[model samples]
Target: MVDCPHLRSIAPMKTSYLALFYRSWPRLASKALQATTANLPNSFAIGLFCVAALCAAPVPLKAQDQDPFYYEIRPLFENGEQLGQVYRFRNVGLIQCLNGDLLAFVEARHDVSDHSEKDVLMRRSKDRGTTWGPYEAVWGHLEEDHAGWKDPAPVVDKATGRLFYFMNTNESEKRLFYMTSDDSGYTWSDPIRIPDSLLRPEWKRWRNNPGPAIQLKVGKYKHRMLIPGHIVTHEDRHFSVVWYSDDHGESWQVSETAVQGSDEVSIIELSDGRVLMNIRSHGELDPGLDPAYRNFMYSDNGGESWYGLETKRDLPWESGHGSLAKMELGDGNLLFAIHPLVVKRKDLTCFVSYDEGKTWPYKKLLHEIGGYSSTIVLDNYDIAMSHNHGFRGEHGIDFVRFNLSWLTDGKEHANPTVQPLPQAPESKATDRAIWREDFELADRTILDGGSTAWKILGASNAPIGAAVSNGKFRTSDAGGEIVWQTGRIDIGDAKRISIAVDAIKIGKFNNSDSLRIYYRLGDGDEKLIESLSFSSDPQEDFETYRIRKHDINVSGNQQAQVIIRSRINGDDKTLYWDRVEVARAE
Candidate 1:
């Protein structure tokens, strides 16, 4: 071990309330200030007051009592008991060292941008991340590097007991760099620019993965250090790639392009000595694909080649980084994934898969608002996910500690199977029309004078490839699936509800192809109203078919929503909806 001036060591404590608040000030600021201060003139003062109140209160560390415990590493501003950093923290990179200590790093930035001025800051947790030491700048600290630094992807070399850090800098152009720490992150070497041979000069832009890299322990290329990253082509195409170093970070080689139309990937070595890369689908960048779903690819020969590229429909990923982790359970294995659940980067949820990323049957919400996450399973088996705690990472980065028992509610879903679609009950005789969408005129507004209107599903507050034109509504042409949902409608005096849609299907259909309808009463869950198989229809081009359900249960004077969605198994398919109606039945 070498002594360095940047490192500051703090004594380990079983539980320290002050220590927790000092580091978790950003968490308090986001959670408390949003709830308490609405008309308050100065939110910054209110935030400080809340911090002081929380630290003074005798709050116990509920590491054992509460599952999925949360704590922030750095705060945006200096609070009553904390010293704020020079810049806010984002893009967290975390890993568990060989000595059982946790090394965490974040991008200290004035704003959250790829080219913003940034510095890499780090903190250590000696007590399994119960508490962490203060922040010390690893790069862009002592030197005045005007250009920005980004994406701290750290890896621990088990054979040499050395820690290798990989990051990118835009000093002149986007370039990759590395630094090393021989003593469990106590000291570090100066930043060394990665040679053009490893990064590939032809690639216009290359970025390191925001999460921690992996070192293979039980594979054909055991002890190989692989870092997941993405390079952009001059044509604006994004592809995921891996850089592997077999000699313990001595030399690195760039693997073949992992997958196209994807970016910001996280990788984990599977049980059968293969690497699985979880990709963030950016189909919008490539017009041929569908966006907003988590994609996967396998590297059977240890990052040398990639194949089996497919999208997991169960995981509805919007547009951000996610963490993929493998959990070992009594002779069997389960893969856990952490990402945002909705169309936006909010509601950070954890999805658990029992059959090696084929399907995800178990999931739980870890945080309300989240962005850009990294996860690691500790030696004791508890999972810690470090992520940006804000909606779009405007606040800062925070890590939540949880376990499988907490995520799955202490239950094991062995041999989990996908639940069959719910069948629509037989319809009774019905009469009056409560709501209808004839698609005669286009209404782009989400709501038209308090009455909900039919709108296509979208991301980042903009509609996708769907439109209402020429007396019909057309689904996206990019394939996969497109969902059309109506806003809440008040079903006044109607005891039972029914929905019907008349549409013409285009392109070939498969056995797995389907058109589904769902209804949600009040604030309850969305229940499936009907599922119609396209294969059952007669083979006729441009033939119009009507799908209807007439016996949906509903209460009077309660708000309800009607949803119509379509999925194509393997080919491109579009739905031209001519008419849709939600009627009242007696």
Candidate 2:
């Protein structure tokens, strides 16, 4: 058993230094002038006294003024240590059972990578997460079976008091499995596979998305159960879709591809019975989409069809899994989102949206370092959440229970107005050029997935034989091949970063071919900053190259690298780049 600690005590609340400086300086200066006149010469004594008074001024009370509430973050899985053995945990799922029990599940792996063999494990908390019990093996390794199980998406059908644990086996075929538990989570039915006819014939590899499943609670399709899923196309592309069950768990139906070039979706029902699906767009594969944010779509007719695919920039995320839930707390219903709010998989923050998914004003950092989180509204209306707390690949799945008051920082009754995001600082003429390349140096060798100064990666992301030809970086001869990756160039910190490159298309270029610019900060994942697509007609003249430039605000990162890539469609089409540069703006 792990000891749970209240968040208020463990983490010191941050305060506004500028507010305190402005409020206390006047009083301190008056006191300093009064004490200095009698002690020494007015000018020197006042200067000495003012320095002392400034240091002695009392700190602000904003942190103490905040209304404190009870919250606990309990460690369930730490560094892959459980059941007297070591194994990593990932792909979290949580659900409140009909009988008020909180059931949590995750994929326990021998290692953190996806290809590692793993088991699906569960834990239960009957007393509203005050205490959690030992691990229960729902599906896992057998002597004859070594196939891995991943992505535990659990849903509770409140009307029938049945719990559905949805998951999939990770093998070459990738089969879907489901189990029902009537007695809360005490026991589960034998793992059963969905029939082949229910799944589309083209979906050779279908997997359950990591998060909680939703059961619609309003309108004509009330009580409809929907869980997000995605299928890998024959060309290795992914599309977000939904698996819905109208007749409870007895039968299930698949929905049309809601968003193409997307994966790992989570669905929430908004007011007026519209189902909104938040998606993880395929950034590297999907041209023109900023990978820093997630995409969204809505379905008015339950999960049968979806429309209006749009990107929500308010959700600050970088291609990691996120969970969404609508909280019916107190006077209004608030939409709750939990995901990595930074470019890296750190700062797993909770965002509260008053106007559905339009804007999020209130937020709380649940964990400073987190990954792949799932949230569920508890029986008492508090949020019971779980996430992978370890940095990078190490596994530390911890659970936390918090309420609306704690999440909103005691501003539960405050006006629910949309908070405008701060605009980027304007650039000035004083901005400096940080890094630039003209490919003017002697030719250098480029290798696939190598440490060479330059590399041309093929579809497999491994370096193929290539060289910087004629003072320019050139992509592979094989066009329209899946993905083409170029080597990285380092750029220092900046308040604003701009990436520019001169490019020319050669041979027969298709409309689908695109050039993308990405940036990486430290050890974090590469984020897609901007993308440029080639024109329908290929340019064969030497003077036809055009400058493609993109600017973005990245204030505090100490180091960054610019990653350039190209997605082409057919052979013989290639893109050439020269005069690449990265600069800092005012």
Candidate 3:
């Protein structure tokens, strides 16, 4: 522990109503007046107000409770990066102990270029969010290779009062590994790996970047805590597989996909026991089209499953990233701070997720920024997020809380009501548990901002290669070992167009392959669009990520029954997907 000298004092409760207004005076005004007044004794009553007004009169703020939602980023380190020098990077988990010391678990990323190795870094904030201590390395790896640890998830078990860290094994395709700190982060425990027969080497390689993010923090006011993290990557495709632990880090299991194409996952619990999970998807490829952006998920049953949370019950994320938080507001409205980004341009946009991530209609474009961000709700309830300032280059993280009024430049009712979900077949994909279910949504979405309609088939618990696999598409069982097949879906339209495909590789392989998106339009020509490229990258494990693509585009609307086929030349693997969103553009 270190010595500290920061002090904050608030006035004792006032029994009289007008006294409340006097206590709420602006700090500067209160300080100036206190020197002259508040010293004299009998400035006593509201009726004696004139005696108090003998020197100066007091004013009151009307409708203070109805104040608009706002937040100003506060740095945890007084000698922060800019302030001076203290803990550099602050990851997801931020916890305050009973003894009055605060702590944060940060992905000690000295390099944010998607190039260097990342590890778990730490800092102690003794004075709440005001300042931090000297930096400490919880899991820093000296070697700069993909084999180093990344994303460290820390949790202080309420049951054990013990601090446990669930991080990834040393390799990119590593399994879950953990360690414990008994002496309140001042000590040690060798990393221990958790084994589940369901883990597949190839699949592990596919999700090599383990965030190991999040450390369970004390809830606003509850016994239950939450532990969360994300499977990360630098690859073009944005995919996030979030995992959560209810009782600290005793054990871990798969949570849900915060967003299909998310990378960083962080969870924060509100005072009301509401758990909000934010996943940063890649908006770099396409904000609306690409999944990278800030996306959200909520869990009412703690962490069982978020497929039914009320968060998106109102606003389904079209896309965006980082995380969100709720604050004790002047008005009854809660405050949220998020670092937003657009996938295609790598542009940044900041906004507010007001109603438990249900909708962010109250948004202000806080610049086109990108990078990891996690916010906190201090005792006074100031909300802020830390992230790289630029949208294109590598920049160290910084935090600041700005208001919604600042973001929208005072705009009103920003998030307009969207088009009502079109009436269609109620989705049957998520209804089952043990097995997978696949149902195609009959309606066509106007994607890429236009005309062509791409059919989408969403699946849940559905085994990919296990049910049907060709050289192109595959699915596996829990172990990611099962492989099945359905050769190809042949289309009939061939005349005024052509057929083509890229490639698909659920798990890595030695083969260079491609799979074409094949289809037959209504009473028209058979066509195929091949644009996927399967990778030929060398693998440290049994898998590889290949980019394969067929070079063809078919006539509009003539595309029928989209199908993918591939020839790996030697190995056999099943390709799987939670859902298939087919966009057959013109």
Candidate 4:
């Protein structure tokens, strides 16, 4: 640990907070300040205030003061490149065997689509994820019978030390089946069908989207293994349920519907013995047209019944699959690995919650361009993450090995030579009376008399991809917002203000969802300036939007700045802004 000269004079709490601030201050201070302060005046007083606030913030343990950890990234499987025969690898499931070996399982698709013919593939890592054995087809179809084995969910029996890998076969008769691995994933037993009586008659036709299973470590249901499963009831309806095996997978009983209009759930037993299930909502069940955040429920009866269903507004996520696991370390912290965007599958971030899954105050971005992910805690309190990343021309399922120190202490642990991907440039307005921003610059700073960068607000998440690219500044997919300051522009002499820009939907266009714009003058509250609703254009393309002088209301204000916001409403529609021109009394 680095010796701190000021430790002697500082209090215990202040010392810890200051140590973390000092370690990350030099490198991350600029970005952190930019993200937190956008509305306040850019003066030395505000700068000092921000610094003081940061110093007083609660700090995690510093990396130098903590035990050393290791991090490594390796491709486990890739699309079109695993074996000569397998074309796609998806639906990752990881488990540590009884013999301390790591078993990585995935769906080997004959084609890229989910409905295509698939099989269960496995690889064993004996040395704590340092290396892997060759691929093994655990289950597959010999002929084109249109039957496929998908969604592998594995749970180890603590009492028997036997691994049970559960899966569902989608054929003329959809059925739940499982295999047994006695020798640490070296070999497996033949698939045995789960009793049809375990499922309700109305749930027979449901398709299972499997996720991680956990054994309750505490409470009355100790050692009970619960496998999280989801099924799509209709095109726009889905629900999450669990299968409980009290006898170590000898027989199983399905739980009642835990959450409605939700799918792809991950459950974790909290320190209080309550099981919390995080689910992906389908939006059809909520009043909101598109639900961007995850829905959660708690079970007190060992996965038998669920209650306390609520939307996690703090955790902003897209309508995609994510993984959650409980860290066996201090306070039994919960770690969530998800695509951090609202409507797109990107920015794979790991969030840590100290008080179970209630509030996630710590986060780390693991991959810039990511898809479905599964997380597993290693034997040594380290973390193993497997996810699909398509960045730097590497498109496949990659594994990342890291520890709590690397995640919380802001230390570089793995492959220090490899630099992280550069962040997208911010969008800043020019300082001229007739200011114009084409968003052609790679920096997010506005080129007024003094350059000022746009700051993120309301949410800590950044834009999904390319905030400023191809001569445009794109809005985020998840209804996040950003603000840019114009400094002290003298527009008091001018009668009216006008703005013109080109806008287009990034993906599919929806008329109900539109980009909203607002403006504030000299520290006043932000007022609505323009609302550029999507037009009924048959073709999905860009259209010019002009805010005339009458639409702009800048009365008795000498200095003003613009605030651009949009709620994509869970649709992956990105609003692109280009050729933004602001004028006075034009």
Candidate 5:
């Protein structure tokens, strides 16, 4: 187990440089005067006096003082490690048992990718996330198994203290299976497939994915066990629902579909007995629809039905899995964790909502580069989070431990300063130029697919394909058909728009490898303006790609948007972009 040291408060150091200078200057000056009066060399005395004056300057502030929030981040599972037969871990699930022990479950993948043959692995932290035990294969085989066990959702029945663990099998007959542990997760019963009576006939053909589960403690559904989940009907149509059991773990029933065009749902019961479901929008799966945003809904009939699909404008997260849990503190505070970006999956952030799930005012960044996070409120009011990341170039699962005070302390763990992108030469004196981004600086707070000045509109789930890395905007084939667009930019009295970009392909290109650029004019859909396909031999160097004004037809629209997308077929291949300039016709 790799341990991340806790951040300690640093005391300001006191140095008397001014006093030393004051005492040394007088003696040095007196010695210089005596040397001059005694007809001896005074050059050495003068140099000593100059050195004392330089030493009197005040010391600069320490690096720790500039940014002081250092929460604990530890590694639980990483890539290339011999943790049983698995090489990677994904889809994390964490819960604190009635016995005050932390049970963390993850999908142990045979490969780094998502669809690899997988198993459900477990680790227990008896001391509240400070330490963890060895990896135990709870489900799937110790050797390679053709069937995959995915998406572990654990919920403990407070009334009976029985823990239920639910997961799905990736076999030909994708079915939901669950096990129970009476002794607080030390052991689990045999895997039992969910009864056919609980599932809708339409859902049998659809792909189902499970998220975190919660045991309701309020109103008419006091002891109901609700597991939030979703089913993908097609590439463009998916919705969220809940599977509930009122009789402990004996029988379960599926709820009505809540939000359409969404995936990976998490639910938290509000004070008024309404369950709030947060869904990740799947706009990227359908090009006819706009880019996705964080969406939400509410169910009042004890998780059986839902309504009100509202977009959360403030939370702006990428299209990835997030976790939500209600704090045990009787104040009705809710804890949420996500990638907190519109385009890229970086900066895993934890948010606290004091007024139920209405608003989130406090947040803390847990990991710089994170994906698919699971959060659980501990028995002692602290938070234990398990997430996916490649720390120090090794990808795996990591756990973070923090509290409410650490989250709301207003200090940041990563770089707090936003670096300005370099200005383009064409934009220096042009009044018609609306927006430009060179991505010269690093700012974690800036939304993914966007800088401080422009908002990037794209699929937040495509992290491997689109990101700002190594001082350049990079798009890789690993991200798979990535498309990113900017918000509308006003064009003032410009007949035509021109853009210049520097791009490069990191590896050999295939037949379908190409970079396509498009623009959307005033309430119109995106229209292709230029498509650059690589037909030449493999080129591993950067090349300038320019879009002339005559190549595009703006149709006299006052506002327009530019879209950049990559269609490549290869592995470990990247396309780097820099020095992007947009200007009016000269």
Candidate 6:
């Protein structure tokens, strides 16, 4: 149960050297590739060779390679186990310098209790990230550096403002450290150690791993610095390599080719530079048991010859950790960040690509399916992700500011001051129903005689639901308890609300039949909002009703809440809620 589908690689799909390098071209595009659930074993023991050529299969080009979505993943950082020493900063990046003037990099992690971390901060946006300037510590976690520099990949050599922040430091064991700020990032120089032959000519049994950054797009490959190195956890040998440098910082070469899956490093470069090295193959079904999905190998000789390994390409990655980014749209058109549409119930969607990573077709959700994300590149490119959100002890780091046609051509720009919202505040567009309260949204009540007692296990209900972790939804309850507490109506200056509800409980009593009110909107599985089951009345002693003007849908401009669920006798329910209204029915 702990593995509904989060990261399961049952095992059994042996072929080694990555399925003999995609079975060596079985006659042009035979679909693509994804058959390694896993059984394990065999390397140079060759016999599967599949390349199948890979062109003209889906055949549909132009309009930015037939766009869709998957453009640079983002989920800055979190903690309870991954970011809380008082909660350091975040891991952001946006270095637009061919000469456009914008610098954004934030890694920061100095929360000491002995998870063994040290300061790794940096922040400076100039004018791209909408505003940022309190994060100073351009990657330096050294007392003697005991381990803790975390994720980083800040580049800005658009011809020398000279700044680069490549992280994951520890000095004697968990290697791969970098930092170089000539003055644009404000200040810094100390931590530099990206040496890596892979560290083991025999150094007393090494230990190092933390890699993320394959940013290219300004000169492509023969030396376009495509770096993506990882081998830092989950019991070593998860192998992730893709290193290339053409003397910008000076010397590096490991073109990335040692694949086994379990986060085997992705190196995104498309924008004419073309460098997509995404590798992850555990087993189509069984082996060491950890290969639920993802597999690829394409190197037009850039990463130094990768003869096309394949898998039937089309992935909304139902497993975790899959990110890629590339943006250029001024009408130049080209945006991507695909594969991350997993769902156990929590937010984990990354689909949106105007053709670059090859294909995603359309999507841009950071975390609404659950866990892990990080995508930042702003300064008119407008895309700042950061997800690891709600439902896992209330995970934090969920901020979204989007564009690129709202994730590749779904085209949405109507926030021009959101007006079509007036479900209540008395305009009588139908009956004045606009309402907005800072009650953190949709759930917060506690009473007895006027009976309104809800604790759907906890967090009163500002958006709470988890039939015990199988359905997934919660906005409050538990120590920080306050799941819901907002019933004050009338919202004017226009905010957000589209109403319709039914579902409540508060210390049941009287044995008379006759009650029905149901609601489920917003957590309706990634549509973002839509679910309203209605009806209510048990003679109203308190657990109340009213808010069905045809169920709401008022998308933002200020204030919004529409969540209601009440069932009796079915799951043994007790109810509450009253005449919740909204106006401007459109």
Residue-by-residue lDDT tens digits, candidate 1, 1-586: 1223221122112122444655567566666766766666686767766776765464533334333322223332221222343576678888887777788887777555666887788888886677778876676642223446788899888777788898886543346777888777887655655656665656777778888999886857998899998888777788888888988776788889866687889999887888999988664344433566787889988887788877787888776899888766556778888998765688787788878887886666666688888888766566777888676566677767654544554454222221121232333445678888776565333323335376666333234445664456755343456677888887887888778777655555657666787878888888886676665432222224556777777755477888877765443555566557788867
lDDT for predicted candidate 4 compared with the true structure: 0.63
Task: Indicate which candidate wins on lDDT.
Answer: 1
RMSD of each: 26.7, 24.9, 23.8, 26.8, 26.8, 26.6
Residue-wise C-alpha lDDT for candidate 6, range 1-586, written one tens digit per residue: 0112422121111212232233233432342322331333444212222322233233422232311321232233344343223454443444544334445444444553224465665444454343445545454322222355555566554433456667654433345556676655565544555664555442222222222354354553433555565443334445545556667676666544344443434556555655666554432322432344455555664565454554424553454444556555544445444334545435455555454545655443443444444564444445565544543313434334445443433343212211121121222234444542212223232321222222332343323322211011222122222223223233444433355443333232344323333333333321222332323433221222223545345344333334343222322333333333345454
For every model shown, what is its TM-score relative to the native structure? Answer: 0.57, 0.59, 0.45, 0.57, 0.56, 0.27
Which parts of model 5 are misplaced by more than 4 Å? 1-70, 81-86, 142-145, 204-211, 234-236, 283-292, 330-332, 390-394, 410-586
- Candidate 6 has an lDDT of 0.42
The true-versus-predicted C-alpha distance at residue 235 of model 5, in Å, is: 8.1
When summed lDDT is taken over every stretch of 10 residues in candidate 3, the lowest stretch is 3-12
**192: Cα error in model 6, Å:** 33
Kindly give the stretch of ten consecutive residues in candidate 1 with the minimal lDDT sum.
6-15
Assess candidate 2 and give its TM-score to the true structure: 0.59
Put down candidate 5 lDDT per residue, 371-482, tens digits, no spaces.
7777876555555677777422247888876544455553422221221211212223342445676665662223344442443344454554566764566665643577
Which lDDT value does model 2 have at 423?
32
Question: Against the correct fold, how does model 5 do in TM-score?
Answer: 0.56
Query: Per-residue error at 256 for model 3, in Å?
Result: 5.8
Per-prediction backbone clash count: 0, 4, 77, 2, 0, 122
Candidate 3, residues 58-95, lDDT tens digits: the string is: 34212222124333333332223432223234234554
Residue 83, candidate 4: Cα error in Å is: 5.1
